[model samples]
Target chain A: MSVVPDSSTDASGVGADPRTGPAPGPSRAARLATRGIPLLVLLVLLASAPLFAAPFTANTLSRILIFALFAVSLDLLVGITGLPSLGHAAYFGVGAYTAGLVSIHWTSAAPVPVLLAAAVGALAAVATGWLAVRSGGVYFLMLTLAIGELVHQLAQSLSSVTGGSNGLFGIPSVRIGGEPLTLAGYVYWYVLAVAVLGFLGLWLVARSPFGATLRGIRDNEPRMRSLGYSPFRYKYLAFVVAGGFAGLAGGLFAALVRIVNPSDAGFTTSALILLAVVLGGAGTLWGPVLGAAVVVLVRDTFGPQLDGHGPLLLGVVFVVAVYVLPRGFAGLAGLVPGRRRSTGGTA
Target chain B: MAGWFDANLVSILNGFAIGSLLFILAVGLSIVFGMMDVLNLAHGAFFLVGSYLAVSFVAGVSWGGFLAALAVAALFGLLAGGVLSGMTEPLARRPILDQALLTLGISLIVAEVLSIIYGNNVRSVPGPPGLDGSVQVAGSTYPTYRLMLIAVGLLLALVVWLVVERTSIGALVRASVADREMVSAMGIDNRKVKFAVLGIGSMLAAVAGVLGAPVYGARPGLDKTILILALVVVVIGGLGSVRGALIGALVIGQVESLGRALLPELASFILFGTLALVLIIRPRGLFAGKVAHS
Candidate 1:
């Protein structure tokens, strides 16, 4: 359970579980993150003109951070919960469209829209996950894909409410007290805050008895059931949690973009989220954020140029990541200490 | 009233005609997936190649030359089957997702490479002269080409069913899917068995591509659509059962065709609605399935 347990190797040089370890003290993840300081420092140097990287680049980075949170949501499901959702775009789109629609009609109380987006995402997740988590691997994947597409098709057909194919646009942005926030600043802060809180929250979840039970379900659902634990309940709980987190990411997205296109809920979007999780290493807390960064850079830079050929690249990455570096970027540290624990089990 | 009846009845005929091709495309997918747990995403790529080959052949020679194009496409499929077999045999032992991801990669590469060479445009393969005209059925005029397509498709389906149900090879596939390692231990060259299974499956997909291209038209995203449809067929029919595939295909075909004719607005939801309900009720599939989800 929980990928060989978090007790084996601690970067902090203190044997501590990532979940229960004291928060105020030097954390184990922070200890692990420090191992990549040299790499981060070098990359920071290359990106020296943080101010001059153009509002465009900064805006793009902001979007990537949001996507990273999206991927983290997926990681919550796939990496931790042991459910590889092919329809994560459902929650993401739900959150995005909710924020867009609410702000368009009401345009009041910035927190309300964000709260509503997460609620909508979680509600949809509860509905879809009830059915989805019941199935095993492949069907679970296909059903999710079908559910995601079903929502997308509905969005297309119900244009009157959904704004149809054109999507909701020209929506108002979030304001703290009647002053508009800087586009990059607002996006950066929101993404940063979500990523941090999300990381800590999930870390806590992974440590709690419930998290341990989820890991048990992931590793051996039948055995856990035999032990008198209803694995289905555990799976349903994880699925709902993942959906809420995914919804949170989607809300931030609507706030940033001010538009919710059909593509937001499309299969391509789901596939991209999968790619980010695979790149970031699924179970690790901060891995998806880093992955979202890589994917964002790739899309912002190469996505336009590739067009139809973009699937080719994403497909290749999916295969290669599964084959070559299954552990993804975060697990790169674990590899050094001969720690082969690569983010949860694959079923 | 009679005139209106005739008008709409012809639409059902057209729907059945279109559905025949869908069945052809989905059949091979159902068999291979049913027998071997491999989800060949590249099946549609084979179809695309077949279509492109047929278009070229039809452009240069007589419409009968389309057969020659099919033969070439089949050969290409065999080569692809063998190569993938050699590369992924070890990997397929684990989970279906790994195989899905691998095939997804291969197909992406095939699509990208082929697009670069052939370019992305809708291309057609002309029908043979004898089968290219109009025909009257039930006091309604239907395109002769479509009527002929329906007949030819039925014949292909019959031939496929006969081979799978009445051959030693079919037995081997049925046995292999139940447990490959057991079949391997039984001293049957399971590799040879699988090689043949994939070759036939791939050829089946390719032939459907060559024949259906003229009707549906070939494009960049055609393969993806075909893949999804095939999966739907397999799931409905139950995975690994040929009869299930056919039943599923026919159900979907009838759904799309009749749904469009009767209720155009809700047409998109018809098949999906069926799928959801069917799955909830009959989680195993239409036909009694040999393998259960792991």
Candidate 2:
């Protein structure tokens, strides 16, 4: 019923799929060192990216990181918990709009708006989750899709707050230490720092015992229920956490792009995030980061040249990915020798 | 009070027109999902294709052009459905997510390609020549095209009922929906049945697309919007039953148009609230079909 055993062991202590447990015949320290090396190299590369890349490239990379964060959060529900939410972008939009509103009306203290956005996202999840968690499988998928469209329609219709279809513009950049972050390079770093922190926090949650129970529920909800674990409670919690994280990503997105349109909360964005997660391999924590990078870079590179054909190219990518790389980028990456088990649970 | 009565009458007529469109579009989706277990996200793309084809084939106010478009769209739908079914055959036993993603990929491709060809603009095709002008009904002037749509919708619903409930092919489809393995055990050639079900479903969607062109128009975002509405109808009506789809579509259609007219601010709220209520009260839908799978 599942694609692969959600190999969850990770150096960062990200939760591994409980069904598979830890890999045999390998020292934990050995696993840590092997995984840590690549992660360290990647982080260092990201930290120094602006020094080498063009300003536009740096800015684009920042946007990629934001999307990557969104995808990673979604992976928690879809990959680890087996919830196929088609409307995950609702929370992302909630965060973006919240941050945008704050920036427009009051403060641009960077962290404050993002934190508020996360809180708002969590609250929205709680409200929606109350009803959404009642069903499973296809029903859940449809419900999420409905809620997403509802939010999108609201965003479009509520022109005063969302600026309707035109979206809210002129969002001020983050100001740190009472100084405005005017430089393009500083903005990139600010986004990177927040995204990295967001990802790390998710990693910690996935590593916890709570994450393990969620995996158990995904594998067999009935079995878990018999064992006296409330799958509903766990699923609800996962939904809220994922929503909060997605909101953080959205706030960062608004800050990075300086705009939040109704489309940000639409099904298209939700589908794109799902595509990235599936492309990266749902179960792996870091795979979606790679997936986000690929999707964003492909669109950025081809969007201008192709004009209207960008979506066509993306469609082609989705079809090819499904047939050729069902296990996704993380699955392909796993084929490389000497890698430790990574975080991610199967559906 | 008389003005309010006229408004109510108009809303009711409008509801029927929208409901019938929903019925035609969603019935196919319901059957395919129930019998084939393949949730073709690309179903909406077929609707878009039908609309676009109608625009090209339709000469101003000509029934011949509309018929031609319908025939071509059905042929296209059959070919597309068959190809997709073949591709999806291997993944039948795989996870639903994999299947959904694959189909979603197909939808994305079709939608993008269409946009590229047609551009991202709303293009309309006029209704048949006979139904071009307004007709007076109950002291209110209404579009003749809309009334025609209502008539055709009711006729199609009747035809669908007769075909599904009274025909031999219907028997096979019902049996297959009940138990695929059992039908195959009875030597019914489940593969052919499956293909037929998918093909017919696709054809129905395209037909509705052609018929609905005048009312909804053809556009870039139409696919997603129609897909969502169809999904809502299917969910509300029940998964596998034909009667369920009819009732579900009509209710949603009425609620959407009437609700929008009655309370603009709370229109979406009321519409979505209905879905939420259905999920809470009867997760299987108002007319829960027999094809209930875990």
Candidate 3:
């Protein structure tokens, strides 16, 4: 009779199930070769990307990387923690606006605005998360939607500060060691570095004991409560952490784009990010990055080609992806016959 | 005080008119969610479809044409709802998120198609000829159409209340909402009930779209705007309760219309602020029904 889906049977194997006990351990060297090699290769390729790519290509890649960070942060909530937030853009926009303002009125140092944005994003989460975390499931989704719309309204009405509908303009390029990185290649390098670092931080957290507790709660909240864990505190902390990273991504986005607008924190952005997480595979950390790339390429890179029917195309993607790829693109790993069992451990 | 009342009377009446319109849009959404755990994100798209139908059918704003438009919109909603029900059927055992995404996708496609046909212009329908004029009320002149809208909304509300509260069909719906398993155990086909509810609910949204065309107009992004408003109303009133939808719509209507007149800068904030405050104080909403089960 329970309407809630069975989380344990989820093919994507996002978070480790408490009931299944710990997964069998891979040998240390074996784990390194399996996980480390591809990551190393990817890093090398991305680092060398700006060397050969055009300026526009570098910029688009930077956007993909920024959104990858954003999508990963949201994955921490929707995929790992099992909280379906529809208003995550609130924190992202807050971070972007904060970074933009910091760059405009204060120093444009790369880390200063980015770090401050993360802090502000976490603070915003604290302000809104306490009330939101009180409810779970669809109610949580509605509350977040309201909070998101509230922030969007604030951005629209606080004309003097947010520049109203026109958004915050005149944002200077990010500076490194007292030199502005004005070129797209240099900006992409900076974005790559920050995104890599942010992704690593989230990756570590997802593998931590805290992350296990979140997965446990997601699977069965009442059981978690019975085991003397306060689901509220854990969810609130996860929300703040996710918000901080989303803000970091937003900060990098503002640095890359050099502007902050209301649409950055609007519902459409939130929906798109959520779609990215779902499309990529909810529980897998890296899957959403792939999803974000597809989303950005489709909406921005190729959307104009079909007479601006990008949304139409995206709509079709959503429908098809839901039915065809339930566990998302990451879940595709589980589809390969013999790889099914192994994908449960690594996917 | 008298001057303030005189100045704001129109806004108050406008609130009632808007509330009625919102009730028509939201009651179906609420009930459908309550009965079937499907939050049809495309509810707004259905409404837009109705509005666009009005734009086409009510060409000269004649009374007969308007009635025909309403009838057509209702039939279209029923057919669309049936399709949506079938589309979402396979995902019934999945997470609400899946259903949400599926409906959102449907809505996007519908909106895109409509925009393609309508050219994204803000096309508005005029009221049927007799109701197109204005009349003096208190110290201000009010649109005759709005008064009619208010009366029609109340009449519809009354009819809906009678059907839900007094009829055997309403008992089945209420029973299903209260306990889906028990209803099925009692030899009822839950899927059939869900289909009927979704169809009726969508029809309400479509009919409201046609009814509200003169006030809100048919526009490209209007679906999203109306969807958000309806979500707010549904949240405030409590999900799945007819009385709650009415009360929530009325409350939101005042908060929106009166808030704008009283504090333009914080008008939108007031609406969401009320939502936040309500969630904080009473997370289940003003008149939470028994149907909300996570």
Regions more than 4 Å wrong, model 3 = A1-14, A335-347, B58-60
* Residues A177-281, model 3: lDDT tens digits: 999999999999999999999998887777766777787777677898999999989999999999999999999989999989998998778888888988888
**Tens digit of per-residue lDDT, candidate 3, span B14-116:** 9999999999989999999888888898999999999999999973358888989999999999998888888989988777888888998888889999988
Give a tens-digit lDDT track for model 2, residues A171-247: 99888988988777899999999999999888867776777777777777889999999999999999999999999
What are the per-residue Cα lDDT tens digits for candidate 1 across B1-294?
887667788777766676677777777776666566677768878888777777767822465587788788888888887787765687655556556657767777777777766788776655766666567788777677777767877887788788777898667777776777788899998668767778777877787777776677667757765666666777777777777777787787777678778877566577678877778788766774656433
Report backbone clashes per prediction: 5, 5, 0
For candidate 2, list the clashing residue pairs, or say none.
A8-A16, A15-A206, A15-A207, A159-A164, A283-A344
Quote the positional error of residue B73 for candidate 1 in Å. Answer: 2.7
Best by TM-score: 2
For DockQ, the strongest prediction is: 2
Single out the weakest 10-residue window by summed lDDT for candidate 3 chain B: B285-294
Q: After the best TM-score superposition of candidate 2, give how far the Cα of residue B131 lies from its true spot, in angstroms.
A: 0.4
lDDT of 2 by residue, B40-63 (tens): 888898999999988889734688
- Complex DockQ, candidate 1: 0.33
DockQ of 2: 0.56
Chain B TM per candidate, please?
0.90, 0.95, 0.97
Could you arrange the candidates by TM-score from highest to lowest?
A: 2, 3, 1
Higher-TM-score candidate of 2 and 3: 2
